[model samples]
Target: MYAIIGATGHIGNRVTDILLNKGEKVRVIGRDAARLQQYVNRGAVPAVGDLKDTAFLTTAFQGATAVFAMIPPSYTASTFRAYQDVVGISIATAILDVGVTHVVNLSSQGAELPRGTGPIVGLHDQEERLDVLRGVNVLHLRPTYFMENLLANVPVIHDYGYAGSAVRGDIKFAMIATADIAERVAAHLLARDFSGSSHEDLLGQRDLSLQEAFTIIGRRIGISDLVYRQIPYDEFEQALLGTGMSRDVCRLFVEMSEALNRGLFAVNRPRNAATTTPTSIEQFAEVFAEVYRGAQHRHAA
Candidate 1:
């Protein structure tokens, strides 16, 4: 059986759907049974429990041949890195305890760096935690900036008529669709071809600056004058806090933006067919438009 942690998440949900459609035996682990109910109805065995609980995770992973794992975001985490460490340790410990043979772990582009990349440093630590294990094969999938991150700008655009962040608007970086990440994870889990731990970079279709991305998003959403602004770091952190994120995680986000502005999160590998995926920003703009329109309608209502 194949097990998927974060089964209710963007990448995990897509991975589960793909595997289940292929008639694979899937054990979907998630915190919300209501959210996982759809997968359960579709023939997935649900392991509903807390991610930081090693026993729960061990139980969830016990019989699966391969597992897809990630450290899910915790917006309200009082100490963000501590929360990440707990979740990461639980996952690694569970894998060791259960003797799961294959693992596809979700890591980030800046994960190679041990510090100064904010929450990404947690991923680096997690990679280290798993790297020491002797028997199980692991593949760390390091994906670049997510296109869906743009969705976070929806409220800002609606309220202020502009898009902005602490990261530089002029810097071009790989922006990938999370769907593409899911495809790579699912393919690896199904193939199970590698014998040792390795890492792969998913660089998306190409690189585009935030300004360039916003232009495409503007055209699709009928906002021809839309532009991306570089908000001051303090302002960005405050905005994040206004969204109910704890100050600790908000600070980490600001640190991540500083790292991004310094080019720390840029694609680390050459642009090759293997690193590049099929989804384009133009295609993702359609998804952006639908979301933008939905937010618009909700505001109007």
Candidate 2:
């Protein structure tokens, strides 16, 4: 049996879908029973509970041959790192207690750095804690910047005819689709080819700059003049804070952008065939345009 945390989320949902299609028994763990109903109907055992509750996670993880784990994003947390640590520690403890033999952890590319990587520091901590488990084989899947993150700019694109961020328009880096990440995770969970604790970096089809990304998106959406502006760090932070993000999360996001601009994420990491995926910017642009049009129609209604 496979146990999946964050089962209703983008990555988890795809993971569960693939597993169920392959005729594997799946147990899904999430906080909302209503959201998990679809998976339950499809033959997954639903385990609804808080991630921080060790007892809940222990019970959910029990009797599973392997598990997919992640710390769900919490924008409302008073302190981002503290919240990540609590969730991370709880997951590690439960995996150990339940004696699950294999685990695939969702991590980020910058998790190799000890500090200055903002929210990714928490993932680094998770890797370290989970690595010490004696009987468990852990594989940390480190994916680059998610292309879906562009969805956050939909409102700004609609209102201002542009998208903006603290990142410079010219800095090129690997960006991946969450679907691709899910594919790799499901493959690993099924094969169990990896032993001991290790990590693999999932870089998308190619590297791209924010300007190039926006150009592709604009072309797809029929906006010939759409622009991507690099907002000042302070202004970006203020905007996120205004959106109800806690101070710590706002600061961490800014730090993460700064780190990306500095080329910190790619340090010592070289892209190879193993890290490259199949999705391209043009492919994802179509998906983005579809979502943008849906949002536009909803607003017009």
Candidate 3:
């Protein structure tokens, strides 16, 4: 059996769906029983509890051959660093106690870097903690910026006519679709194959400037004059608030954006020919229009 923690989340849901469609038995862990009921209806066995609870995770990991592990950001904390420490400890302890053999962790690219590594530094700590596990094999799937990030700005795109960020208009940064990430995770978990302590950089077809991405969005949504504004770092708090994110989360996002502008988010050492899986931003946009947007509408209703 394959287990997915945070199964109700965006990437987790996608992972469960893919695994189930392939006739894999999936155990989905979630804190909210009500929320988990949706997955139960879809043939996923719901394991309900907090991921921070090692006992809960131990039970959830029972009979699972491989697990998809991830830590969701807790912006309610005073700082991102604190949140990272808490999340890292929780996930690492669970992995150690669960006795699961293979783990596919959701991490950000550039997380392996040392101090001053920006928002990804916490993810760095998680990878480090897992490295000490004695027998289990771990795969750190470090993906670039998620396509779902744009969905948070749907209101801004529709009403305000623009997508704003601190990134340069032509920075040509990598972006990956969450569905692609989920697909890769499902593939690895099903095979029970671990290629040692490897990190997979899930890159999109190519790098795209914020301006260029917005242009594609404009064409797809039938808004020719759509724009991407490069806002100042200090203003990101307010700007993100305008987009409906909490103030604390917005501040962390500002830190991430500033880091991105400084090139902290760019991928280095492209994957070798042996393990490259590239998805184009344009192809991802089509799915955004079809799958994710429709899901969003249903959620809103």
Best by lDDT: 2
Give the alpha-carbon lDDT of every model.
Answer: 0.93, 0.94, 0.76
Please rank every candidate by lDDT, starting with the best. Answer: 2, 1, 3
For model 3, the superposed segments whose C-alpha errors exceed 4 Å read: 241-248, 267-278, 287-301
* Poorly placed runs, candidate 1 (over 4 Å): 267-269
lDDT per residue for candidate 3 within 188-212, as digits (tens), equals 8888677557677877556778788
Candidate 2 residue pairs in backbone clash: none
Q: For residues 1-301, what per-residue lDDT tens digits would candidate 1 score against the true structure?
A: 9999889899999999999999999999988899999999999999999999999999999889899989999999999999999999999999999998999999999999999998999999998988887798999999999999999999889998889999899988999999999999999999997778799999999999999999999989999999899999999999999999999999999999999988888634578999999999999999999999999999999
Each model's RMSD to truth, in Å? Answer: 0.9, 1.0, 3.0
Candidate 1 TM-score, C-alpha based: 0.98
Candidate 2's residue-wise lDDT over 169-229, tens digit each? 8888999999999999999999997899999999998998989999999999999777999
